[model samples]
Target: MFAGSNRLTIDDKGRLAIPARLRAQLADEYGKELAVTLGPECIEIYPAPVFRTMAQQIPKIADRAKRVLVQRLFLGNAVESEIDGQGRIGVPPLLRDMKALGTDVVLVGAYDHFELWSYAQWQANNTEGQTHYADAFAALAVP
Candidate 1:
């Protein structure tokens, strides 16, 4: 039930700390292991078990082309990491390059995972979402 946004900085070592409030829940549910990967527009952090479930779902895809696409988008770039005692997870250079992560990043809660977006990208993304909110909400049947 992660539901908030957190603004954080990437340390010199490229580590981003998970917000304290969410640390305990993550520790309890997934221990120190996490699976990180590139999303369409951001880096996504997932509990190892949660990521395993997601990986399992990929293979069930019936469309060969779509399945391959999912595999390449997810499996190909996925990296397994461990959260340290201070609650920090290291973002690999490749992942950083792929997502264009700058020093400042925004961690947006996304139910099953947290999305990491550069500050500028997050701002732009929010602006886009704001413009489409009415139509998006209507599509979701929100009244």
Candidate 2:
């Protein structure tokens, strides 16, 4: 039940300290292992077990294009990491480079995983989301 958003800073070495509340939950239930990969517009992080479960659920495909896409884009991009004693998880260089992440970032809890967004990127995404808010809500049938 990861939820809410928090502003954070990436250390010079590209490690981010997970917030205490979420950190405690993860430590108790999942230990320190994590999987990181690039998302559509941000970096995604999932507990290692959670990631494994999700990976297993990815439907098998006979279509060559779909299979290739999944393998190359999702599985190939994933990197395993461990949260350090200080609650910090190091972002993979490839993942960080893809997202153009800098020191200032925001951690957004996206239901099943977390999205790491550079501050500027998050702001731009939020602004664009506003333009589609009506359509998005309508699609969800939310009143």
For this target, which candidate reaches the highest lDDT against the unseen true structure?
1
Candidate 2 backbone collisions, by pair: none
Candidate 2, RMSD to the unseen true structure: 1.8
Per-residue lDDT tens digits for candidate 1, residues 26-130, read 887677799989887799999899999999999899999999998998988999989898899999889998888979999988997889999999999999899
The list of candidate 1 runs beyond 4 A from truth reads 139-143
lDDT of 2 by residue, 1-143 (tens): 78999999999888999999999988888888999887777999999999998777556677878877777877889988898889999998788888999889999999878999999999999998999898888888556
Models 1 onward score TM values of 0.93, 0.90
Q: Which pairs clash (backbone N, Cα, C closer than 3 Å) in model 1?
A: none
Error of 2 at 28 (Å): 3.3
What TM-score should be assigned to candidate 2?
0.90
